[model samples]
Target: MNENKKTLGELLNASYSAFGYAIGFSCLVNLLMLTAPIYMLQVFDRVLPSQSSDTLVYLTIIAILAIIVYGILDIARAQVLTRVSWWIDNKLSPIALAKSLDHTLLGGSYAAQSLADITTLRQFLSSPSIYAFFDAPWIIIFLIVIFLLSFPLGIIATLGAIVLLSLAILNEKVSRKPLEQANTLHMNNQESISNSIRQAECIQAMGMMSPIVSKWLHNNEAVLAMQCTASDRSGIVLSFSKSIRLILQILILGVGAYYVINGELTSGAMLAASIIMGRALAPAEQAIGAWKQAINALQAYRRLQHYLSQPETRPPEILLPKPQGRIDVNNLLYIPAGAKKPVIQGVQFTLMPGESLGIIGPSGSGKSTLARLLVGIWPPTNGTVRLDGANIYTWNRQDIGNHVGYLPQDTLLFKGSVKENIARMDKIEDAKIISAAQFVGVHDMILHLSHGYDTDTSRYHLSGGQAQRIALARAFYGSPALVVLDEPESNLDQEGLAALELIYKNAQKSGITIIVVSQRPMLMKHCNKVLVMRDGHMERFGLYAEIIR
Candidate 1:
């Protein structure tokens, strides 16, 4: 990933057919554009000498038609390029999103960074500027045309181009270190600012506003200093390059004047040569800048690729048959990354169909981790988690997802209508959505809104409890075989908690296996059995009364 071993041509070969076609069309348009100067020169030098009114009129019409043709080609090329960009973006977005989602399921520090890098790569790759490779080759074509027209003039143009391009490339290299640093610092500053604003009330309550502001200001100052230095250096380099290019241009014209005096070149030819030289050199300037940005984009891409290539906890091809609403963990020893001790050493548990199990533990116990493993969010390090006697890791990811519903501590609600949030998919029936919401005690809340289920609650109108209930409704909407709830009772009031208990009871009667990780004793009271964990190890597994005793 650290090596830059491939050219843009090789990299783009991985793109789809539509992308290739679009790039090809863009190149064609650029080649066509290069011919316009040659045509103009021919008209000025040859057609004007005849000086016939009809001939001049005809030539003018031809030139106008050519301009119109060029305009059409340019428009077509732009349209094709846009389509390619959209196609590639759409294709890559899902892969990047899926990788991020998968990383979330397998939590770790590297996983977190991998998700962020995927997002950045998606954004950078989707930009239209990344596909500038198609237009770069036209610079060579322009130079060749200039050489064919006048060799000495072409040499001067090439020399100026090299100088300007070298300066641009060097400028890019010098700025990269600072630019990368500035970007990272800016992200840190933004995070600090966001944290400060989000916890402004807490800061004021604790009289810690000064400290929070100071930290945020420190991050901001670092970012600003890096940006200022990079910008100043870039400006100086650009100014110098422009000055040198202008001098080279003047020298070329002075040499061309000598050729004209020797009757070796026409004024129109010299003018055309200059125009072509500018056209030839412009893309070189663009390429220098593009190459710099591309390098940065590629670095981000390598990070993203590493994430996409990470091994999942379970492979997709492996198949675990649908369970009979039973789960078992036999002598399971769960060790998280960088932990010296297993979280759930020698933990043995089993649940029959229609039975409800409650997991209870203090903070730092492995209650949540156990629930995650049961639901196949992660694989055990030293033992097997079984579903109906089939090892859970043998189950396909989609199959496990379909049968096991997991609700984490934090409930995420998307910005949409209440119905959209509840259904989660367009194909979900309205009646099913209503029933799920009603069962979870959020139907009444929805009905009270202006549009009932159709009401948009994206403006932070819903309370934490309301959002949690909605999330629960979504989880239960499909009637999964097993449901794992982590801290589901945290934000609920007494009535809401009672409603949740009733929902679980109903689910149990329907033969669904319910596993809850909760700190509340009241919630545990309803369970048939309770598993108590301490210091990442299960201390007891028995009925609630037995465990309490």
Candidate 2:
């Protein structure tokens, strides 16, 4: 698993050759930028003085050709960056998605931010903003050319470059904090809105929408204020830099005119020197213009680096035989990441092959947490949960996935056909889907839908009871050896309850071990053993009749 861990920095390092090509192209583009000034010099100094139309025409032709080549090279540079951006996205998106899922499963928020960061990074990579930095270093070439034209002009141009560079630095320092703050607030606001949307039915039914909207508006105002602060600061710097560049260009023209009058520089040289000075300072001004994007991209890059640096959570792939129905929990404890108290602690139990156990507990007594542990969804902080004598959390999912079934409390049905969801999103034989559906007695219910087994879950809305039945079929898919069902009967009706009993009988007949987190009497009658829990500790564990007596 470690061998598969790849970082954004490492991926960029691998693309160094592509960047090198872009830099090489930038060099040629910057060199070709001198075409206009050189052409001006030749036309004004040599062509006019010599009174030669041929010389002017030939100069024009050469300048046009140089500009064409410069345009082609510039396009090539952008193309290279675009391709590199795609390559990085292709490699890092899956890793980002996996990490995002792991982070969410571990009870963290901001899962969407990882993908958003990738978009920001990719946009900056293929944007004109990045090219500004590449073009920045070549300003020295323009300054040198200015010096060769006139020493005084060269000094002035150099000072102008230094001043613009300072403003660019100042822009970064001033606007970075507010921009970063605004970005953080924006992400929070997005998460808030997403949560509200997900619970829109509840909010509307309970008259909670007004309060939720008010709170959202309040948070959004803060985000806007921070963004305004950043923009005002950047605007000031950018505007000042633009003004300074214009003033310098005018100053150069005035100085060149004076020098030309004094015969210290020729007319062509004076004109060329002013143009070169403007070219020398253009990069710094452009950098100021795009400073905000640069800072955002830098922040995104850093976040991705940290996100990718996390240790791989997936177990290494190994060929292991299918697990029997045995489970062993040895002194297991689990404390959430930022919590002081454990959700489930000192939990120890064992179930022999094909034995069914029912977990009973109050609302906050960690029954769901224990069910999660049994299915390897959450790792224990201390001790281990072993299936077939191997730690369940460390068992390679690819090897053990087919042998286990889990129905989470939420009972989510992914967007797919009824048959596809029953098959756990795997495209498999229709016989397996039908058999799994039949095991849970949902096969007839599925056929009554608009498209029978092929109905799209996204477009068709199932009633709560119907969805639960379908989810039950999914849990019973493939005749798994171990099945953990959390609050499985919450949405069931009388018929559904009868189906649940049939499922238990079918599971027992097939020798599948069941761990159900429920307290209902109907479900309890089918369990051989019952484990009672309260306050993160086990209250009792024995045969169902023994516990009841």
Candidate 3:
């Protein structure tokens, strides 16, 4: 297990210092924003009336310098946010991908959604919607300046702020449900499409394309409707907020004029007040406009939190000697995560090194499930599986991975060179890969490939038998002490079956413990012990001759 696995919140919390720097930059940028209005004030009150070119030139140079500094700080603020986004992505993407793989093994759907959530958060951090928040707190600074210029004008700006803030709240209230619903539906649709693509052969052969497309469109239509509802409502609120800000600007200027008429305010102050009022209301207006994005990011963060909440409890690896294939099971029972009944129950068995066990059963007899438990892919609901006197489930897999070989019922080969696949993606020498291939009788078949041992599985298509053989070779790659093969001969011809028998002979000679889940006569003949399963129960266990009799 990775000791550095962090929950999403912790990862985000770790980046708080980066965000603090961004905020500091934003602070400087916002303070520099005062340069524009103040320049207008000085030009109106001092330069114009002084009728002196020296004063005008000096003010212009000062204003230009201030604006230049403001621009640099603003760019720096955005750069900080960008780096923070990358930093968080660098830390969290690997964890999300690892967790997604774990989730897939646990039969979870939409495993890629965790990665997508990280992407959403990364984009949100780099987006302007976030900067609106960083600048929001400075709204009061502009408001207080407005008050100093004219009290009545300040009151109007404050009212405008209240109205726009109210609209922001309204935007959230009305749009949250639809946005959340739309996101859920969208994710489900993506999962369905991805699954359908993987099974395209079956779907196309059975003429399921039309119905599948229609159902997909129906789901998409529902998602679109929800998104439209949210967007329409958000648009209305955003438009309203903008209109209010505009009206506030005009009202500030009008009230400032009235005060100027009474000698309570100067003309320079009147124009400055209008500009300041707009500045005060800008953040609220921008927030209302980006409210939908903000909501999406919040929801994405929450989803990431939920998925990453699982603790990595795999114990630290201890320097233990390699397992020698001795096996034990006591009252082993397993029920899947959300199931009412156990898939396998009250089953117990043991095998010594160099022994072989054959598990035979009907279609729904849980043979495959048992094989998974034996290999420690799934933890038992009750009891334990011990290999060489250590709990197989608790053993650090990395420490003993080479000693345990598993060939799942549904064989899958990764998109890599033939040698890489045989070596389990480990950086091993060609001699070892050739040995595994030769041991499993796949060496000749692999040499016949276009690139021999270097063929990429993705580019060079293979028949079902070919793929299964490659997976078999992988299982035997390291000369594992315990090799569990589920239906190993299902896709093999007579030649392949003969090869499998030869491998079994090789295993016997090498002192490897073997478990085969099959009723195929060619495979069953090689098993000294047979366990018969029916509806997840061990109905018979003894010598092969007695079980067959």
lDDT of 3 by residue, 23-78 (tens): 99988898888888898898888888889899889989998999999999889888
In TM-score terms, which candidate is top?
2
- Candidate 1 or 2, higher TM-score? 2
RMSD of each predicted structure: 4.2, 2.0, 2.3
Worst ten in a row by lDDT for model 1 = 1-10
Please estimate how well model 3 matches the true structure, expressed as its whole-model Cα lDDT. 0.87
Residues forming the 10-long window of minimal summed lDDT in candidate 2: 1-10
**Which digits, one per residue and each the tens of the lDDT, describe model 2 over residues 53-136?**
999999999999999999999999999999998888888888888778777888767567988988998899999999889999
Give TM-scores for every candidate, taking all chains together and pairing residue i with residue i: 0.86, 0.95, 0.94
What are the lDDT scores of the predictions, listed in order?
A: 0.73, 0.88, 0.87
Residue pairs with backbone atoms closer than 3 Å in model 2 (clashes) = none
TM-score of 3: 0.94
Per-residue CA lDDT of model 1 for 30-132, tens digit only, reads 6666565756677778777866678767767776776777778666666765655555455555655665666666564344354455455555545555544
